[model samples]
Target: MELALGELLDERLITLDLQATEREGAIRELAGLIDRAGKLADRDEYVNAVLAREALGSTGVGHGVAIPHGKSPAVREAAVAFGRSRTGVDFAAPDGRPADLVFLIAAPEGAHDLHLKALAHLARRLVHDEVREALRQAGSAHEVVRVLAQA
Candidate 1:
C-alpha cells in the first residue's frame, strides 16, 4: 500500500522542525528531528550515513526543496522527517538556489525499490508550488501532515 507522508507522521514516524540553516546545518537539524520523532537507533550513525550518501551527490532537487535519504541496516523501517529553513538552506541544490523544504528519509538496506519509490513519490508531490507553500506555512507538525495528505 502507498503511504502518505502525513499518515506516516501521524503514526509518529516523522517530525518537523521550522528552525534550520543551510547546507550542513540542515543535516544536523534532521538528526534532532529524528531523535525527537523516535525513529532512529543511533543519532550520529544515522546522520553520518546520510551525509556520506550526500557526499556522492546533492539530494537537493532545487525549487527550494531537498530530499536526503540513506539505506542502512540501522533502520528498523522506512521513515521520513521533514524540516523547513525559513531563510532557505544551501543544500548544494543543483539549481544553485537555497532549499526551504527538506525531507530526510531512511530505509533498510534490503528494502530495494520501495525506498526509491517513496522518494519518487515525494518528489512528484512537490511538483505543485501551492503544496510546497502550504507545507512552508503549516503551523504545526500535524498541519504539515494534513497538507501533505491533502496533496
Candidate 2:
C-alpha cells in the first residue's frame, strides 16, 4: 500500500503544545512522542540518525516549518510525529524564521525511503499558506490530524 500522511501521522503522535526552546530539544521531544507510540525500537539510535542528518544540513526548509527525519534499524515502523510550538523553536531555517510547525518522520532502515516520501508529501502540503495557518491555529491533536488529513 502507498504511504498516506493521514495514516502515518497518527493522532497519538501529534503534540499541540511543544515545550522545547531549541532544535535538538524539539527533535528529542518529537522523538519521545514516536517512542511512546511504540514505533521506535531504540529511541537514541533514531535520534542520532536525525541529528546526524541535521549536521549535514538543517531540515528547516523555511516558511516557519521543519521536517526532521531519519532511517534506522531502530524504527519499528514508518511513523510521522507532529509538534507545534506556540513560541517557535530556532531550527536555523533558511528564511531565518523560527519553526512553529515541526514534523519528525521515522522510517525503517531498509524501508526503501519511506521517510523521504512522507517528507515530500508534507512539504507539498506546507507550501500552501492556508495549511500552515490551519496547523498553527489547530486547537487539539485531532484538529491537527484533520488538517493534515485533508491537506
Candidate 3:
C-alpha cells in the first residue's frame, strides 16, 4: 500500500506545528522536529544540510505554501511534517506572499518516487481553500492530521 502523510506521521516519522520566526528558522525548526520524530539520526547536521539545500533555490512555491525538501542519508525513509502559521511567515514566495502553510519533506536518498508522490499529494490537497482554512483553524496536530486524512 502507498504510504499516506497521516500514516507516516502516525508511525512516528513526522511532526507538526513548529514555531519559527523566519525562513531559516522555519527550516531549522522543521529539521529538529523530523530529527526528534525518529526519522533522522543527527539533528543539527540534518537541519544544516536541508538548510544548505534550500539555499540553492527557494522552495516557496507561492499561494501561501512552501515545500522545503531534501534527501539525506540521515533519513531512514520518506517522511513529511506540516507546520502552520496563523500570522504567516515571510518565505519570499514567488507570488510575493508570505507562507501560512509549510510542509517539510525528507526521504531516504533512494526513495525518489515516494518523495515526489508525497509532494504532489501535499500540493494537490492544499490547492483547496477549504483545506487551507480548516488547517488554519485546526486546534492540534491530530486535527491537522485528520484534515489531511480526509483530503
Candidate 2 lDDT over residue span 1-151, tens digit each: 5557987888899999999989999999999999999999999999999999999999998899999999999999889999999899888899999999999999999999788789889998999999999999989999988998888
Model 1 residue 27 lDDT score: 75
| Candidate models: Cα lDDT each | 0.75, 0.92, 0.76
| Candidate maximizing TM-score | 2
Q: Give the lDDT of residue 123 in candidate 1.
A: 81
Query: What's the true lDDT of residue 47 in model 2?
Result: 97
**Model 3 poorest ten-residue lDDT run:** 9-18
* Per-residue C-alpha lDDT of model 3 across residues 17-135, encoded as one tens digit per residue: 55686888887777767777778876666676678777898888788888888777778756787788766678778898888888888877777677778878888888898988887
lDDT of 1 by residue, 1-151 (tens): 7756653445253344546675666776776666666666777777788889999999999999998888877766567778877688877888899888888887777888666877878888898999998988887777887787778
**How does candidate 1 score on lDDT?**
0.75
Task: Give the top-scoring candidate (lDDT).
Answer: 2
Off by over 4 Å in 2: none
